[model samples]
Target chain A: MSPLVEFRSVERTYPSRQGPLHVIRDVSFTIERGGILAVVGESGCGKTTTGKIAAGLVDPSRGTVLFDGENISGFKGPELSRFRRRVQLIHQDPYSSLNPVRTVYQTLAAPLKRFRLVKNRTELLHKVRELLLTVDLTPPDDYLYKYPHQLSGGQRQRVAVARALTVNPDFIIADESVSMVDVSIRSSLLNMLLRLNQELGVAFLFITHDLSVARYFSWRGKTAVMYLGRIVEYGPTPEVTRLSAHPYSRALVASLPVSDPRVARLRAQDDEVGSPDVPSIQNIPPGCAFHPRCPLYMAGSCDRDVPELMGMRESESLHQVACPVVLTR
Target chain B: MSIRSDSAPPASVDGATLMSVRDLSVVYRVGNRLVRALSNVSFDVMPGRALALIGESGSGKSTLGSALTRLLPRTAEITSGSITFNGKEGRVQLLDLSSEELRRFRWRDCAVVSQMAMNAFNPVMTIQDHFEDTAAAHGLRDKAKIHDKAYELMETVHLDAKRVLPSYPHQLSGGMRQRVLIALSLLLSPELVILDEPTTALDALSQRAIIKLLRRLRQQLGLTMIFISHDLSLAAELADDVATMYAGQIVEYTDVFSLFDKPKHPYSVGLIGAIPDLSADGASLVSIPGSPPDLVSLPSGCRFHPRCPLSDDKCERELPLLVETEPGQKVACFHWKDAQTLKGSDAFEGRNS
Candidate 1:
């Protein structure tokens, strides 16, 4: 079966005062039906732009995006509406994404009503309660009348998820969904998303800067590591996080602080990147965007040639990297 | 690590405490209700040690930081507490200091680097102007001398001083602004520095840079610090001692090694279990069952009892005080002995499993 969504050499650029800013370039990936693909990167790395492109919310300047084997740019009217309903985007900030004046029932029921998913008030109420229950907000009656201001951050996020599910979406783009919630409640939210994927067959494009979170959410799927708007590493989640081949991925994984003090103390001190500053998106370094900060950077090749994503020799599970220095070694 | 000439003496030499808090309780008046922001919170900061206050939002970690520096908001009142600081002159009670003395004590003795580095600086003023204004407030008016010191400190924090000192705050990136804030915090060379979520706003790579810089500063300067953060991994990376706060109380206080290796409080265990571990393959994460309680109307007995898995009638009826479970470890839970046997996953197994 064809993948649910595919990006063919996608490139997006936004006009700025200092010429055109290359937000994302040569980004290509696929999200299979009911499969999870997490895009991991730092700020201004174009992960959000990539998500918007996948959701049909933004147009790519240079490449084609295929949804269900059809080019998204050609979709129009009813077909575009259908695509929009099928692919939903959940934003990062629950506090701002939700309407403060709308109650939980109203927030979830609006989408259902507008999509003609429910006939009357009773059906709408029942559907809203079911949506809340599906997201694990138990005793849905207790939350139906509460406003966004009355709910906690976790509850607000769950309500946002329930609203996204009101239209019966086949794919969800969760953009940093769990980052704002408290750590004590973050795992439960991730577990809820996983449950939805397992029970309802919903695919996810989970975007996060946290490597550990991406690894946890997409353990059985794939991870794409983005640096300065390019995918430097792509592979199975565990391989990308634990045994990464690219210099950027390796440095990111190494620099993460382990929860155990003993392990943290024993962490190798050689993972330091050359510079602490990430170049502005408008002024990204030429060649490999990460070469200026890569620790294993070669002088001539790293500064002159841009490396393409290539498969690793030793990895059997389709692990690919974009660093020539590490690839040739 | 060669000690700098201006660095303070090693903390372990005399084993003297730098700052001590006794029964500190702060309450904020919200409309018609009195919200207890902090309750009987107490801890000690050694001269060279870094203590991490770990908790979620509304846990009063920030309030406690404000209380220590006597910078609490107008609505907040210190109902009961004493903050004692051992400085260059002698022992001084922070709460009893006059307004003028508190002004001197804040920057000269203790500096606070808050979480919002984006809003910490004046937008119109250059980085040099900020340094000049700060130094001028502390009676250091020599511009050339200040410029030289600022240049040295900026280099210490690994910034390009030539480009940064003349640029306004908006010209610098988030990471650069944060590093400048750290540099400014060290301008006075205060004995104690309080940082609230120093790296919470930066990206992962930038966070690593700040952590490494902080470690280097501690080694070279023997700086004493109390950092308020919600990230457990950061606590493990930077803290010498870890204090876990839950609903305005210290649920667990122990060395960093002990807190992560063998936590003795149920909340601490739950929090540790909730963090996703990258190194451990297929490790299941378990989140706590409920949200933090409302401060205005708290549950009876222990504040954490409502969400704790091991809570019993004894835990519901009477409040538990901080008691020594080990040589230096302290826990404020009635079932701490039972909590000792529970791993992070075991504590919240059925909830998320």
Candidate 2:
């Protein structure tokens, strides 16, 4: 299956006070058509930045992102606008995502009007109601005249989702969209995305810090484990989850609260506190950026040279892990 | 690794309730109509024990927290609810507290470290300034006394007292700020402390740090706590007892272990199932279909019936009452017995951990 979206050696560097910050370091992955690919990492891991790059909100410092096998990295003008319409980005805060002053009707109508998706007000209103029902925000008429403040948190999130679908984008870059919403409604929202993927053949570049959520979020072409600002491990969710080749991936899995009471009780004794320590991009270590904290680090080799993204010690497909432990083995 | 409880608390309190919440409700008026944020809620908070008020947003978990502290926005009205301190007869209807009484009772009687509560501190103010203000308000006028107490509080939360005392809120990481807030809540050793989503904004490491620190603190001080949160996992990690609230009403209240292991209410089971668990494999994401019912036009029977998979016609017309079944567990579901048949499927098991 060809990918609806593909990242080829994508890198994003931000000019910081002291030097350039390597936000995305030699990252590459793909989201197959109708797939949900989640990039799991802690905050400040450049996961959000990578999502923005895919959505065309941020230009990459190095490499290209292809959509439908087309290199639109430098594409601008009408073509870029069309790409923007075909791709949408959902923000984190639903409360702030919509205009507080406008009613749901106006807010929904504004996008349709801007995109010129509909001309007449009557038809536009009908289309707005259609979008609302599609997202399961039923009895759409009730929400038509309601202001953002009048709606509940879950309702607000649905509005945001409806807004994102206003342009009928085939690909969505949902960046922590559910993190800010209540946990009770979050599952339903994720299910909504799943349904959309299956029903509309839409693709998603989901970004989140919750590892479990990413795993359950369905078959993203590849699931990548990001550390500081690098894709340390990228592979099929099941493969990477079962045999986490990279040290960072191992730590991440171990960090998740064990759902089994027996294991959680035992884990409660370990003091493996995750204190994120990312070196300033400029003053990076000689060989491996993760060597300082890597538990299985072989002193000389790990510190002397950087590891590339490869499935050297594993049956290579899309399962890419950056570690000598796997590579040397 | 750390002690679970500092010391067991005495149950009898001279024949009086430890914490009494009368017809407690909170409403924030937007334009013309009043948004019923919380409606006719009541619960008790006992010393040396925790009662977690669990609910999703707009479910009024934070509103409930703010009501306990008399810190609701000016527009917000405490329609009714008299929160009386256990040790003292100083009863103040959180809604009825006079400005002076609110000033007096703010942190000394019941303190708050709210949701994203790290932002509770003013960014411009130093941690020392926050401590001094709180201590002075409680009559800890001696500068040295306040400073010593603040250092001790920091130590309790594993914060570097010396380094954090002079730093600003912006200077500390999310976890550090949370720890500072927890430390500040202890400044007066307020018998009852209200924490709203204290660890929700934090990472797993920070969350564990807060949870473990709180467990230790509970043992040392025997603090009466009212923990309000949306995250059941964290709630299970800390709260001894849990109360799952919905549409402004508690659906279930029981021991933390039982609540997670076997929930009596459909809403409780759905809440537990909805959480994404990393340890559970192939646990495809499951979301409760449909949104929470509108409180204004609440369903006649169980407010959760519309979205509840177990709902029947009887559930739609007649309301279910919260009846005590087991020793500690209470449920509002008309058919809670059927809930026992809940599968330990990917969506239903929240208690294993």
Cα-based RMSD of candidate 1: 5.2
lDDT of 2 by residue, B1-353 (tens): 01112111223223355576644667777777667777666566666798888888667777777877778888888765556556564544555567897787767778888777555888788999999987877777899988988988888888889899999988778888888888888787677888888877776556766777787788888888888887777666677788888887778888887887788998888777776676556655446666666655566777888777677899989767666899868888988988856544444322210
Those runs of model 1 whose alpha carbons end farther than 4 Å from true positions after fitting are B1-15, B344-346, B349-353
Model 2 docking grade: acceptable
- On DockQ, the leading prediction is 1
Give DockQ for candidates 1 onward, in order.
0.75, 0.43
Q: Write the per-residue lDDT of candidate 2 for residues A1-329, one digit (tens) a residue.
A: 56788889998998988788888888888887778788988766789999989988888899999988888776789989899889989898888889999998888888899989997988998999999988878789988999998887878988998998999899999888878777767877887877788899889888988877777775444588887778888888888877777877776776665433334434644324334334445666667777876667788888897788887454866788888666777
Candidate 2: which stretches are off by over 4 Å? A99-130, A139-151, A166-168, A219-221, A257-271, A274-306, A312-317, A325-329, B1-17, B29-32, B88-106, B294-301, B311-319, B341-353
lDDT of 2 at A250: 74
Candidate 1 per-residue C-alpha lDDT over B290-331 given as tens digits, one digit per residue, 9 for 90 to 100: 788888888888888877888889889888888888888999
Question: What is the C-alpha lDDT profile of model 1 across A54-139, one tens digit per residue?
Answer: 99889999999999999999999999999989999999999999999999988998889889999999999999999989998988
Best-fitting candidate, scored by lDDT:
1
